[model samples]
Target chain A: MNAPATATAQRKTQAMHKNLQAGICFWSFLMPALAGLVLFMAIPMVWGFLLSLSHAQNTIHPGHFIGARNYTDLLTDPEFLNSLWTILVFTLFIVPATFAFSLWLALAVHSIPKGKAFFRTVFFIPTAVSYAAASLIARMSFFSGTASGFANHLVGLFGMQPVQWIGTASPPWYWLVLVSVRLWLQVGFYMIIFLAALQEIPRSLYEAAALDGATGGWTVLRFITLPQLRNASVSILLLNLIAAFQAFDEFYNILGGSGSSGGNIGLARPPLVYIYNVALSSQDFGRGAAGGFIITALIVLFTLVQGRLLGFGSKEGR
Target chain B: MATPMLTTPVTRRQMLKTFVFAGGALLSGCARSDYIDGKLVLTQWYHQYGEKGTFQAVHRYAREYTRVNPHIIVKVVWIPGDYGTKLATALLTPDGPDVFESTLTQAMVEAGQTAPLNDLFTSQDLADFNPRDIALNSVNGKIYGVKMIDDLGLLYYRKSMLQSAGMQPPATLDELMTLAAKLTTPQRKGLFLGNDGGITAMLNVLPWSAGADFLVNSQIVFNTPRTVLAYQKLQQLNQGGSLLMGAASDWWDPSAFTSGQAAMQWCGMWAYPAIARAVGSDLGAVIWPPLDAQGVPVTFLGGWTAMVNANRPHVEEAKKFLQWQWIQNRAIQTDWCVGYGFHVPPRLSLARTTPKLQQPVPAYAVNMLGKYGKATPPLWNAAMGSDLTNAVTNIVKLGQPAAQQVAAAADMCNRELQRELE
Candidate 1:
């Protein structure tokens, strides 16, 4: 072989050897997580899809495959329909409320000249609280239906009669409990995310806007601040939307009867809760899997529609 | 960067990859059952009872059993939080409990998770148990579970409240309604049948109280005109602004009654000791009053049962332990029922002779169990129960027409029954 060719061959072999070594290292690092994902998530998900087509109930064994039957049955199932409606209603209110509230808090916190870190930590503290504990606190102290409840006691100061916040079906004051506890538990995390995104916005943009006769805070926020936050807001909105749809812990813990008997969850039985009851309580794994896939499809569809409507990935303005 | 570095063929990456796979395999393998001292180990699962001493008692029983049968070591798994769901999920796995305590239903039998215990029971032992319990636990005449206790559920009312309101214990739903309104004061509400507004526990009892059955020979019959009328009456209670709603705990806990939040509560006999300690003789219980003239008052009988997992490797040993614990060990059974929580011994002989049960209140409960106690129908599974709850919620809480809601729920339940039949 010629000298240049020999050197080229040697370098090519070296590159190949280097690439192979890098590949091995990458695989070594990735394999553990990949295997876990396949075992715990991917495999079960595929099994669940199979289960959705079956008449299988309690047992993991897919006894019989009655294709499309569980899905069709779910379409007519009143409990499933009610749960879907409940989650849809919940998501509609919660997503917007959380987005606006978190954005407002982020803006307010970001604008603070001093003790910003302290306030940020204070606001973010609730994110660390488990949904179960927060729901319990809401039920036991704040929105308790008794006359001695915190909310009731506050209302009594204005000569208002004690309200049955949770138990009353007429007004559905339990919504306040469910919505407020969720907001308290999740708002902080979303707020921090918004705050981080806000900090990344160039200071020059705000200065230029201020110099260009945009003196009012509202005007600056309306034109620049919100538009700049599009990406972060979309992310937060999508996350909140998905999270709201999957709401179970707060509703289940607060409204669901004490953990003695498997709680009497009424009025606010979301789709996840309904699926859990079907899968776990009734041991109807087929129906549960079918409902789960329906919910997954719903979420994906909503996210896609939202992305398209908002031009989420487009860089038209940015 | 050099040719020698590449050509030397470093194997660290490969070794690391191998290590990761090996570690995962090792960790996963540890989950399999282990033998100690070459003894066959059997794991039994039990739901965490709210009653004190239940954990210790269960562990002690397991230890005692192990001591007697040295060849087999019994491991007691105290499962808390969603025990039913957990047990059901666990039963799907090979490593699931050998024996577990839960309400024995035809679903368990149909699912083939539970082994029939008829072979373990003597005819005399079968005769000793409450026939209603055996029938409820049986599917197609093959008994699947051994009854551990018979929990009596009825209405607990405060004597002072009743006396102040000038009311004898109510005999019918109408009278109870009137008494509720009259007994309700600024400090206390008239009744609390759980925060679900009597939809959770009392809904099933109401239909029976109204002289209606949930299912009669594979036919849904809970939506009769009488049941509709009875539910409508219950709707009045929900709308009447007299119920103590949204207590800290549910109806299962005696706190609502003990704290005087409710003058009367629908609760089980398990709360007797706690109520006595808190209220001191102020508590009195009665069977849920009838709905109309044709109806008779009813009390609910609910309790756990022991069954060997049909899938367990040690099914025969599990069944032997069940027979030993629940059948032969009458003292253990009595202690389990009455020692910690006030449960009526399923054995009529033990119930008759047990000292704690012969007390005034307990004796009254025992009498009610004999006279009015009804085991839930075998057809009334969890799914059907949830459907009935929805019907009650519709009829009572939402003020939906009783006939329509009950009919809809009953239709759904009948469909479920048909599915189960299939």
Candidate 2:
């Protein structure tokens, strides 16, 4: 009891020294990234946020402030609400599917004992492809309205009336095509992470458990795989959630085209797409910035929730 | 792969080389005074489809201009298709482009990025450009751009298809619809009326036949009974099931006509080359169907413009480039139009007397452009009657009632009018 206070002080000094070291390291690492973060991310973000409180156009060099008028106007906009609803629906479907599919792929590849390297390579290869390339292929295959697409070809082979994928009242079916492509593009990356975690699991624990009669699939999975993957699962879910929330590039290229060509039906217009339309196309930067910031805030909030749930990176005052 | 873009052996050599080579000649490029005489550095901004050739042309033209006068060194900046974001960045900057072509919207005028070109262009230049193009260049009676290229609504179809159908191009909307129905088959459709909301604004011309403007004299014209009827007529054609709605809607290769899927498409002259590519020498073009009453043939005109950067050190040189490229260099204009397959010409002579614009098939499109072509209306924000006629697409997406969407489109126009006017 006499030494406890002294010990605590000693711990405090050690912690302070370590924290200072960490602080120095963090800044050193961040300095390089700071330029990019400020120029590409921070300035644009703040500028966009400022723009939201204005009456502006595409060529408006300097617009006047109108306060919260843009947000208020967005609140009144039916199309805006509808676009939000569409994005919410897209997220609800896509995020879960991505996790389950990635996990399954990881499990499949991990269980392969002899050719683990080969399977890992095969599985992770697709992660290199961008969403834009995948989307183009998907659009050509399923979303295309004419028989020029693969879905129509398959449907024709089966002797059915050709169903419209992208050009219909229920475009969610076409939305699935986009989501599935996103999953295909992302699963490999998460699978690799899961594989790493799986490899890190103690072999002795499994052997000891097997000897103690904890030999079945569910038992092994619950005691070994799932427990081991807590960190990886959390990391993947948080990273992927951020990705899903900011789903823009795929939606933009698929809908808006490479340059300023033209739009078809715009079947998969996510929130980003709608907001971009508000900002650039319609030249209302204020609403666009507001929408983008709101999306960022939502992503951060969800990441916090994920961190609380999964205990990623930090193991302190939760 | 977290590997370096360069290999290990050559990394040091490459680094030193880049360090030595970079910004050296480029330094010389920027070493000169940013301003020459009273002429300041002026940046001109515009979007181009075929950029590489224009880059070479402008660069050569700049060098020539500098050699002759040595006053301004216009830095010809090429901004690709992502013009909106980049242009926004430039506009937000303190030393952004002084003059650039822009869509005539209140946002542009209010931003102060664009100064009125009404004063820049002389009365003669204005007269030569036409009143409607003048209008598109203006926002609230102030012209901020020199309407670079003029576009107008024109009727383009397969001449072979029209001939086989045993009919001439329809002179009235009703006859046009009849001809469309006659031409449609299971393998192909009568026309491709499914381009997002693009053709939506053309509702002005249709309603104009009934003596209605796109917007009212000062508001959106879609809610007018005539525009509604036009929508209804379009809906009827859709209901007759003449379209394969799910086909890839890439307008660049307009699938309908390219794949033998569409008999006709209503478009501006801009689509001429693309149409020619689609049909492979079977393209036929004509002006928009004339009204039965026949007051005057009308079509919407659009084109790119060159804006001078007032802050550029090479303002005189840049102005010389703009003059040579836009005014004096007919050969450049001809080359640009022909190279990018641009249908409209900056100058009048390029289309008629020039061999380049005298394409055998699209003579009708050229004729329409020359004779009855007009630019987008000056007060087009609240005045023109076009509603981007394809609002049915969004309606189809949300499963909203078609009537609701029709009304919503009208509301969109009215809202834009109110916002811009305010």
Candidate 3:
């Protein structure tokens, strides 16, 4: 009986030692990434929140605490409100447009049996281009206000006079330039995502649908293909929505002044650009930080609502 | 068989020792090689100027500084884009430059970003520098920056275009509009304020030309009938189908004017060399015409100023560097102003003595600048400027009511001013 009891005690000690080893292994794997997240992301977020509450002008450090004044000020300010409206309009335009175009490209590419890789690479090439470079191309070459611009040249061929594509705000023709540039830059990325999802849809579904007397083009697409792509479609919509709200590079490069002292055109100023101007250009860090948080909350609220409606991450979504 | 060497289990102490050795090696490899035994290292920052040779000029100045003071080394950092925003961000950090060049704003002074340079200049030195530049850099009886160069903005028109059109250079806003209309042709538009129309350069020009001051004794004063009338006239000009809308370049560049896309361009003195090279004898410079009889012709005085960072550890050394580079060293100042591009020296004495200023085109520009040039008020901060710029855009492009827009802008400016005062 004594020998048996001693053996049980030895087994228990070995089990405890194995558990200790496992814990150390887990922590060793996790510590670097965890430290990075805490240092770079978590610390800045908390510091930014505190900065939003203070009157930090021309400085990033928190100054006198004026609770909620910056928030109230931004909420009431017409320019800030207008920026919100501008971003909403941008979202309304960009999200559905990118989704539809990307989906269309994905379907087109998937149906092609020959040179599939070629077409896919061709469509995906724009994804590699930087937004700033693309914006410059769009502004200086394609949609320039000059008569020699590509768009103006095309219009001139039709016997229409050259229209000032970017300079005039009365007709807001700049939206066409802004939308097209963003679409060109982003559509390829979303198309690749959709292509991956399209491959995941089993070949058996199309066969099964056809066996059930479903027609080839419209019926098969509507019933099997559409349902299969729901997860990807929802994801792309959310991503596009968030990206639209964060629009800065194209608008800034195309419409903003050339140098540091240059100002962006007020017509299509989105929220991020407005906040940047407030914080960096105006040197009002408190207002800028407050605006940043407001925008963050807005993005979060939008993402949640969108997720709920689309059932994102749900078992049904999968 | 014994355990393979590769399969051996390492103890925690051995692992820590390995990490320690690796860290020491990595750190030693990363150590800076530029360090000397007792030399003080100074960093100076400059915004990239668009003209050719400016980069080389600034680097040469840094090399020269080291030669003058053997114990000190000056590192010149040429910031390429978005300079103001980058400088503002850098100024908040501990490793910011010891000396930098920028326009002095009230917010910078309020944040204690720039050191007062009263001791760097003698009374004679103060008198020699342009008074307008001194006023622009002063706040609360303290001078915070020494002007490095003075850039004067004016109208550049093609003499041949105007002569062929049988028109003199416009003497009034009305005449300017009429001349623009007369010069418009099938191939070219008449004027180019900027690529985005007239919002960038004309922001201050319109107000000052209309006999309206942005501020008077810290009171908002731009919201007046004259200013509204000026906007109305500018709106009319923009709508007249004569002002060049889409150009290859903005107004700051002489490309549109020299390329004959526009007959008249609103630009600065820096464009003189390029315009001379392109248009030769056809280039003519004039002040922006007054709005009405009650107003005055306007040219804006804009340039870079050298300031020592107050928060840096080498504040005294930085101040001395600025003094040596911009103040005491007249030869370097002249080279910096005239060698790369055409700019008026901030020192009046230099401007008078420089042979380049006596040239016909540059002398005319100097004369016009002396008569009508106005520096932006230090109190007219970026936020206030944005409000006015928005007002201008709305009135000119969108056809909004000028009076209402100016009034709204005034309200916003008042609020910003109140914050500054607090």
Candidate 4:
């Protein structure tokens, strides 16, 4: 009996030693990434929150603490409110348009039996282009208000007047320029995501639908493909929504100009641009930081609402 | 599967130690490279000027400074785009430039970003500089910067276009509007303020031309009826479909006027060289016209000013460099002002003596500046400027009521002024 008890005790010690080794390995692997997150992200976030409450003008360090005043000021200010409205309008336009275009491209690519890789690569090429570079192309080449611009030239061919694509605010033609550039820059990335999800749908599922006399392509697509793509569609929508909220580079490059001569054009200004003008241009860091936090909260609330409406993480969603 | 080779396992402690050692080595290497044996390194920044030889000229100036002071090496940083924003952000950090060129904004002074430079100039030297330029660089009776060059904003019109249309250089707001409308053609618009229309450059011009000031004794004063009327006239001109909108180049480039996209453009005297190169003997300039009989012709004076960074360790050294380069070096100043691009020297003595500025267009610009040039008030901060810009954009582009927009802007400016006071 004493020998058996000693053997059991030795086994327990060995198990304990193995667990200790495992714990060390786990922490050793995670510490670097965790340290980086704490240093770069978590610390800055806490500091930014602190800054949002203070009058931090022309300086990053917090000054006089003025609790929620910055937030309240932004809420009441017409320009800030207008920026919020502009972002909302932008998201409404960009999310649906990008979703549909990407999904269509993915479907078209998936249906192609030959040269599928070539077409995929061709469509994906734009995803590699920077937004600022694309905005320059859009502003200077495609939608320039001059008669020589591609859009103007196209309109001239139809005997239509050359429209001030970026300058005019009445018809808000700047929206067309902003949306087209963003779509061109981002659609390919979302298309690749949809393509992966599309390929993951089992061939047997389509076959089973066809066997049920759903021989029409639309019927098969509606019954099997659409339902199968729900998860991907929701995820893409979420990503697009987030991206739309964070729209800055294109609007800034195209509308804000070099920031040396003219100030912001005061049209099509998203939240980021407004914050940038307030914080950097106007040197009102307190309002800028507060605006940033408010925008973040808005994005979170929007994502939550969208996820709930779409059944994002429920079993049926998959 | 391939055979595994025996290797020593690494522990977290060992990894941390290695990282710390590597980091130390890298830091030491950087420090050794940065520290020249017995030389004092000073960094100076300048915004990228859009001229052919301006880049080389600035570097040449830096080289000349080093020659004058062999032990002190000056590093020239040519900031290309968004210089203001970049400079503002950099000024917050310890590693920012020791000396830089920018407008002396109230925020910069309020934040203690600029050092008082009263000691750099004597009474005679201060008297020699343009009084307006001196006033522009001063805050609460303390000088913070020395003017590098003065850029005069005025109207540049195609002589042939105006002649063919049987129009004279406009002297009043109505005449200018009429000339612009009459000069409009299928290939060209009447005027070009900028690519995004005229609100940016014309913001101050409108108020000044209407016999209004942005601030008077640190109080908001740009919401008068005459200013409202000026804004309305500007809106009408923008909507008249004659102002060139969204050109490939902005008003500053002179390409719009040279390419015949606009018959008249609101631009600065800096573009005189480019304009002469493109359209020799066919370019003419005038001050931006006033609103009515009561108002006066207006020219907005803008320029870069060199200031020493107050937060840096080498503040005294930076001040010494600025004094030597901008205040003491007359030949370098002349070359910088006129050699690359045409700019009126900020010093009255220099402007009077510079032969290049004695020519026809430059002389006229100098005269206009002497007569009608208005320097932006030191109290008019960026926040106030932004409010005014927004007001202009809304009134002109979105068809918002001019009076209402001006009032709103005035209210915002008052708030900003109040904050500054506090």
- Enumerate clash totals for all models, in the order shown: 0, 38, 0, 0
The candidate, 1 or 2, that scores higher on TM-score is 1
Position B270, candidate 2: lDDT: 61
Candidate 2's DockQ: 0.31
Q: Which consecutive 10 residues in model 1 chain B have the weakest lDDT in total?
A: B1-10
Each prediction's TM-score versus the true structure = 0.94, 0.78, 0.94, 0.94
Error of 2 at B20 (Å): 22
Tens-place lDDT per residue, model 3, A56-149, is: 9899988689899889988977778888998998898789999999999999999998999999999999989999999888888898777788
Model 1, residue B223: C-alpha shift (Å): 2.3
* Candidate 1: regions farther than 4 A off: A1-30, A259-264, A316-318, B1-30
Interface RMSD of 2: 5.2
Q: What is the TM-score of chain B in candidate 4?
A: 0.94
Q: What are the per-residue Cα lDDT tens digits for candidate 3 across B1-422? A: 37684565545676678768977998788644333668888888999888999999989988899898999988889998789889989898877889999999888999999999999999999999989899999999899999999998878888888899999999889999999999988668888888766877777788789998788788998899988988888788878989886665678888888888887888888989888889888778888999888889999888899999998877989899999999999999999999878999999999988998897889988887778888767887998888787788778877889999999999989988988889
Docking class of 3: medium
Q: What order do candidates take by lDDT, descending? A: 4, 3, 1, 2
Could you give the candidate ranking by DockQ, starting with the highest?
4, 3, 1, 2
In order, what lDDT does every prediction score? 0.84, 0.62, 0.86, 0.87
Model 4: how far residue A130 lies from native, Å: 1.0
